[model samples]
Target: MRLNKVVLMAGCAMAIGLGAVSARACEIKIGATGPMSGAATQWGLAIKGAADFVAAEVREAGGLKVGDETCQLKVVTIDAKYTAEGGAAAANNFVSQGVKFVLGPMGSPEVTGMKPITTRNKILMFSDSYARDAIGKRWPLTFHMGPGPAAWGDPIVKMAKEEFGIRKALTIAPNDQAGTDVAEVVAQVYENNGIPTKLEYYQRGTTNFAPIVTRIMAANPDVVDTVSTPPGDAGIIVKQLRQAGFKGAIGRLGGPGTEEITRIAGGLDVLKDFYWFEPVFIDDNVRALQKRYHELVGVEAPENNFFFLFVAGGRALAEAISNAGTYQDAEAVAQSLRELHVNDPNLGQGKWIGEKTYGIRQELSLPFGMGLIRNGETLPVRRSDAPTDE
Candidate 1:
């Protein structure tokens, strides 16, 4: 009897040791892809920051449930170098590695490349591109993390007309897809409302906008609205407008409208009448997001698309993981994702923005807030959801 009792105690200890080993062995992998270098390096790095921060935050929070075990975050990053072929290859690579969810490149080319592979693998793709072509239409496994340029474009025009007292407008944009989309956004709304529009398009990198400036000056419209890419384009457009003696009203859709823009534009002094929508509004939601973001990244809150949208995206994915606990299946994750609120970044506050359909199938539009540079700061001009004629 003494020998049997000692044997039983040893067996119990061994079982406990094995169980601890099993618990410590589990891991989960998440993926993010972008261009990590070159002219667009800032955009790519911001995305990487959001993805890495979320993975770290989720891991530190004790990980996702997986069948009597828990797993920590294992983030996989692919550098597409901002190319279509590169993006397609990265998507295939992620699938080969058994990762089924991915965040795609922020621009049009990369998102276009990854679509096919994502659909085949049933990977849920979330993008930060401003192309309207991607939305108001559906892709099998693709989703948007924010409003399209078209979504915000028309509304800003209405604001320009009513708030700034302008009807007839002269507009200029680059020939790229994003620029075309922004111009179309304005035209769709303005044409429907019977407002006359004088529109012009240019190649992406033009050193002398003087010809275009001269033409717009000749038109002499009430508002000169412009939407272009990079800090360089906007800075030049605004600067040359003042330089070329075209003194009509100036409206800017500043994508590169970073704090850097005001400085690059020779100071906000030159951007007096420009307006751009804020990806994040100045509400409790944004403040709470900034706080959590600062806590995780050890820097000032990223004020661009990556900061706010990433927090929103991570919360959505985390809720899904928690709800689908103990089941690491892809279907389980996808289904649970639809059920999660994806609320505020504090991860403790603000309910998800949409109704039942938001989490379940898709969102009507990821929420956005509009703002204008007022008194040298981006001030909330109006809520993104403020009543409109839809």
Candidate 2:
């Protein structure tokens, strides 16, 4: 009896030791990189917040299952500072830490910079950037979070033209790849809609837009488009344009930042007439995501609507990881992701597109919305169906 009791205790001790070892071995780290500072800070925060919320949700549901072992999901975030160099450094950091999956690097320049590192290291990435080459056939492991201007620009431009009766338009942006790429696409859309357009660029860090505003006013454009300009810069440009006695409607065919722009430009009244692209249509279902995020993360989600998009993307990544049965094999996980049906409880159904523009069908096309502020009164966001390769 004494020998039997001793043997039982030894078995229990061994079981507990193996359990601890298994727990440590099954930790999966996901890397989230974006511009966590400067004017684009809100965009970056959305990426981090989405990853954090997804990690928490997985933990609350008894952890993520990868094959036989239940794995704990951990998010490791880095601020790419909205720059090319920053993005490359972040990718190197992730590789050194053995992180095989990545979530962001939101700006065009950052995506361009990070692609080489991620591709070389066989890391899979889901990125949000308006650059033309944000995702392509060369980088099979890279995916786009949503459609860029090339997908949704036409309808929004046509709506603006019909509603406001704008004649000629001018697009202003920073003189960088992030700006030029989106600006050219938006400008082409405006011109396609029979509205002649001109392109203007300013140094990225230019705080005062007085000179640029003067140049814009010289053309006497009936509408001015702030394509791909950072929200902070857009607000200043809008305020200066209004102050200079320009009564034309303002357009933003770039990323969503209406909240930040309104606050910086004083108020909606100051904006007068404005039209911009909203990434997600804020219906009750979408609003419910905020509640879930708060419940799991213990804080309010970032105000940027990009947060919702990232949440959808993050959940999809988790599913792919589980399906592939290993986070270490990025190619296998990428294959799993490509086979996903693109459905989300909150965001509803979506599809993978982009063969025509990017020469690859890796872009996630989800329903989007357009915001309008006429005579200082904000209207309901108008929903648009997901785009196709056509």
Candidate 3:
């Protein structure tokens, strides 16, 4: 009886020890705030879904290595409804949850509102906006993941002049901060490239483009460029422009505007002389990833086309945490991020840039691709200059 009692106590102790060891593994939480409802739901869904997918992938691969133990990743997404108030609320919720890393609260208004909350809590936010106002000293903790307005507009204007023989351009946008910023950048680029540019602004949700298109046709510019127009509105513009008999070239200083434009225009045949500053490098490897993603999720990749950045950011954060030897120290993790030279098939090779502009080395400077819609497919035209991390 005594020998049996001893064995039972020993087994209980061993079980408790193993259970404690299992519980020691950390649960890392990543937060994402974006417009998950209303017109911009696609953007939010893409960012959130990509982050969740990457976390799942990491979880499947035996979790993230943090010091001597493995940590699991959990992506917590909140819908901001494309409003500043919504963004602030989401940021507060993340603060309460003790989340240090956040993916996005896209658009100028959403990001602007979320900035104070994120700064107060020392949370690292990755912004997707190309507006210059979104960065700088005010939002020190925030990093711009997407390319700047000039990055896209410069090439598009150059392409318009050299390839399409476009000498005159007219720009239209939503009149919001992002639209205004992008429009200004594109106009400047066009002017510099010897293409005289005119500007027009419209309120958001203005579906009726009859008046707008009529006015654009009156201008009779060689190119009609849409700067930072949302997907739904972009489609409306394209369809209406065709109906209004504007035979000038159509172009986008921002976004590929492929699937949305195609669906709304009824077919690719409607899009004549269209060009875009593509966000993603649509190479063979990225195509493979997109196929696999569709198989797992039952839909095509996000129209935003920068879903790979979230995945890369997640992996980079995990690596940073491991290298820093502490998950709680955000500054150390940020430093690690700056030091990382990321080379992914989806994003291609790039590293942190923008110390001269943003007052910090936070922006990921990667090779920006330019393309045109040819036969219902995006065909690359040129590759922008990017400093390779040697």
Candidate 4:
């Protein structure tokens, strides 16, 4: 009797082990890589939050349907630290784990670092970098999360000129590819709009901007634009600019971080004359998206508005994975993504653009907003249509 009982128990244990293995086999892992530490941590967190929320949504609906099997969606995140080496390391980590899809590596340096690895490993990536070559025909598996300043800079520059009557502008950014690429584009736009502009660069990781502020004040620019500067650094520049009594309109013709900038510079009153590019105009639909995130993910979403953009991208990726019927086959998934209509329930209609600029139509073009603060009073964001080749 004892020998029979031992035999039955051994069989049950083996069956349980097999069941666990089967369960793991059905899990689909997606990676979220970005600068999860330092000044740009907010952007990385937004990417992670979007991935987690999408995974939660899939799990709530009984997992993602791929062919006949319902596969579990899992998000694996790594901190790229806003560096080239960090981004490459993150990609290698994903490759080792058999993760075929990745969400971000938010900076230009990070994107530059990860591109070769992602392409070589056949990992499909959706990056939110403002680099000139962020999306190209060379990396067909990579897609842009949103259009860079090349699309929206002109409109914002025109608005600033009209509102603030700025004649001369000085743009400041870190002395690196990430900063120069965006600053040059924005400076061109300002000049196109009849505003003479000067380009200034500071070494990265410089905490004190008093020297830079002194140079800017010496130039006596009617407006100062912080293009592609991290929010933490930009805030210090703004505070010192104000302290030095250099009262000119301040513009962020780069990524949206008005809230953080405002906080770091003290408050809205300190950002007396400010304008920026808001990736999404918050409305009822956007608010509903945030509420859904809280309900599904059980926490408040990241404060940066970039969260919405990542959410839209994440949903599209999930849909493509389901339609492709195989997450392991990233090429098939990329093809399906290329055919997908850029429509998010919350963000509404968008389209793929960037053919004229990047030689590929892989960039996501969505409605954007121009934010303003004049005389220390905040104004509602004004919406603009998505940019086209025209």
Candidate 5:
């Protein structure tokens, strides 16, 4: 039996039941594995909700058009609990369930553990993790959804140089490979810009940051950069830094979870001297998407990095499948994804950009906004291109 061809006609979808492919639409499942519980639970929840939001939007558009077949997308999410072991188990379960495409296993460590299983199963993967070292030749089937560390670091360096006249930096991050990678990128970017940098590692899950804050004060750097610290930890660091009498600039070198971090730090007041990078402008267009997201999910969208990235990434994937005219062909979808120029409600204007570093045109090119929290609101101070090593 030939598959029915699905097409969008006059702003609606119709499945032509004229072929061996039945008119009855099939469901295409996209699996998401992440830390649904544990320290990173909020990140997991937001990403999952964003994926669902994308699915809901696609469904509202009368289902996804895949060549001649109209398919409905269903997101199947598994909790990885923010650990390598848990991620492996989740990937194994996904493989068993015959899930071909997966949304995320948020952390690089989690991806490292899950990659073997996902690869064995030939699953196409998308993630918000910015660990660039984890992508590239080794992981052929996986793609990094948003800007990585270099993307974050380069813009901050440009902003610091132009606006703050910053010359030195001190970085604090969780003691892990992700942290190490982020610190390395920022340090290199800063050093190349003629700014000396130092890095400090903290054990994950530490709440009282008094000692860390004291050490940071002693360093007396011009900028204190948090390298991929969780929202809660970033809050503590920011608050404690202020309390410890440090009056210098601060930068969130990773994708900053703005809302969550500000809330945890007691409000936007605590983020007064902070600067971070956002992939898109949160103008009226993006705000409308956030409103739609809240209405669909029954929760206010977190103004975090991955919230927008996941929504945009999910939409991009769907578009790729439609353009490739196949829901089951991962490589075709991957190729299509690279060629897309995205201008969605959530993502603004973007194009896939990383050909030199990853050896594939995979990274999304967008003007990253340098944001600052001032007078109780977060606003864009400047906008610049994401770091791409040509």
Candidate 6:
């Protein structure tokens, strides 16, 4: 989890029921909701791919263990179209389908909208998105798989102190829950660390950022952490930053995690002057997955997103089901999940922490990629090399 550097291959298909299974006993009706046809559809599409892959892989391998039942995980994908209403509808459908376990609908509002449904039905919802006030209560069945935007903030500052000699920083985020949340967390840490922050927020989709740009530069912080979509939108902010001629050092919430942002910007080196967060590790197991994923999808996987995270999440569910030893009691899956633990063939060991209310804290191991943006690329600036707040 703390190491990087990769060269990997897919592993042999192993026995499903200890041999190799195409299908089997228990049927786990799990649902995944996402914006399959909206402006923010990229995330949903990636998650759909990830969930599908995980469901197939796990089911083929005999299914997960729950107490003593080897229940097969059956994933049902629902298109939310990036609307809270759609999410609500999707959650209702899942509940009707008797899906006691569920994944996500891309970002924040979806997670917030589905809460009533998940909570009412006692369905456990796991999201690749950050935590919000609606999900504020740690329900017995909801868990946030990814860290809040703030996840990378502390480490970015830590690295700044050690590497950039930065005591002053400017912060930018779209004026939304995800954006503001990341800014708040970062600002808190910066203030706590005794570093002054030139914090600013803008409407996420606003066209002209000249004013914001001018304001940020005027404050003149040593570095900037532009928090926005891990991909698409964040690019706009960074592009504006460069155009405005303010280039000290920048940290992005998850900019490097998006291949398009990197490729379009020219190369990974564009992020060379910025700090970025990586959702999954490129360990041997993960690399093996990447190879197989590419082979199957014919498209190289994005570095982050629910694309791979869902597979890891599905596998985690499978392991829990395997440990449960039975599949009859849907509610009991959490207990079974708690009892089982394995090195996620994707994320890493000890990556998931048990939080019954929120299911599993899917990625307990946080490995953020701190890189510098240069020539329109992100190069390795440094790595946190530790979990949580390194």
TM-scores for all candidates?
0.79, 0.94, 0.88, 0.93, 0.87, 0.78
Cα lDDT tens digits for candidate 5, 26-142: 678888777787657777876787788877776656677786666777889999876678879988888888787788878767787788877777788887665665567667778
Model 6: per-residue Cα lDDT at residue 4: 16
Q: Which residue segments of model 4 deviate by more than 4 Å?
A: 1-25
lDDT of each residue in 63-165, candidate 3, tens digit only: 6666655667778999877767788989999989989888887777788778898988888888777677767777777887766656556666776677678
Q: Put down candidate 6 lDDT per residue, 1-390, tens digits, no spaces.
A: 101111121232335555775434456777877777633566777677776676666544544444434445577989875556777888899878888777776666677678787878878776655544524445555655545545455665676666567788777876666566557666776776677877788865676678887888788887777654545555655667667777677666533345555543445444446555555544565668878776655677645555666666666665554555544454576665544554565555544443332333434343434554455544554544425422
Question: What is the clash count of model 6?
Answer: 47
Q: Against the true structure, whose TM-score is highest?
A: 2
lDDT of 3 at 379: 59
- How many clashing residue pairs, candidate 3? 0
Per-residue lDDT of model 2, residues 19-137, tens digit only: 64222446789999898999889899999999998888777666667776666678999999899999999999999999999999799989988999999999999999999899998
The CA lDDT at 144 in model 1 is: 61
Residue pairs in steric clash, candidate 5?
A: 2-20, 2-21, 3-21, 4-21, 4-68, 5-68, 6-68
Candidate 4 lowest-lDDT run of ten: 1-10
* Cα TM-score of candidate 4: 0.93
CA lDDT of each candidate? 0.60, 0.88, 0.72, 0.87, 0.74, 0.60
Off by over 4 Å in 2: 1-25
Comparing 1 with 4 on lDDT, the higher-scoring candidate is 4
Q: Kindly give the stretch of ten consecutive residues in candidate 5 with the minimal lDDT sum.
A: 1-10
Error of model 2, residue 78, in angstroms: 0.5
Tell how far residue 34 is off in model 6, in angstroms.
Answer: 3.5
